[model samples]
Target: MSQKKVDAYKAEKANREKIMKKEKRVLRLEKLIALAFCIVAVVWIGFSVYSKVNEGKEEVVVNTEMDTSALDDYLSGIATDAADAE
Candidate 1:
């Protein structure tokens, strides 16, 4: 082959190799991005579910009633005792 044709072939081969490398890099980057997105989505969903499951119970309630009659009687007795002492 002529020198010009040989040089052209080498240049074309180099261009093809460069294109292939770029395509491969782009494909690898796309795969990595998809994997990262999947991981993030899974983690977000898991966290949401965990928070919902572990959240505080909203139905827990406590009811109490106190009687004050005994205390009042005791105070009245003390007042009577003090009056008697005086």
Candidate 2:
């Protein structure tokens, strides 16, 4: 082989260990990131379910006021008119 090709091959061999270590570190980081994402998704889903259950357990209150005086007056007028007709 040529002198240049021999030199390049030796240089690559010398750095093979460093390249393998870098690849292992990248793979470990990817696995850690995937685990973290799964944990976060589970926590989010649990929190939403908990919140919905608690929301259903809560009581809602409604306040309203009504006046019936006009209805009473109208009924009384009707009664008087019926008596007058009789």
List per-prediction Cα lDDT, in the order shown: 0.95, 0.97
Per-residue lDDT over 8-54 for candidate 2, one digit per residue giving the tens place of the 0 to 100 score: 99999999999999999999999999999999999999999999889
Model 1 earns a TM-score of 0.51
How does model 2 score by TM-score? 0.58
**N/CA/C clash count, model 1:** 0
Count of clashing pairs, candidate 2 = 0
At residue 44, candidate 1 shows an lDDT of: 100
Q: Which stretches of candidate 2 lie over 4 Å from their true place?
A: 1-3, 59-86
Q: Per-candidate TM vs. native?
A: 0.51, 0.58
User: After TM-score superposition, what is the CA distance of residue 26 in candidate 2 from its true location, in Å?
Assistant: 1.1
Worst 10 residues of 1 by lDDT: 52-61
Residues 1-86, candidate 1, lDDT per residue (tens digit)?
99999999999897998889999999999999999999999999999999998787577689999999999999999999999999
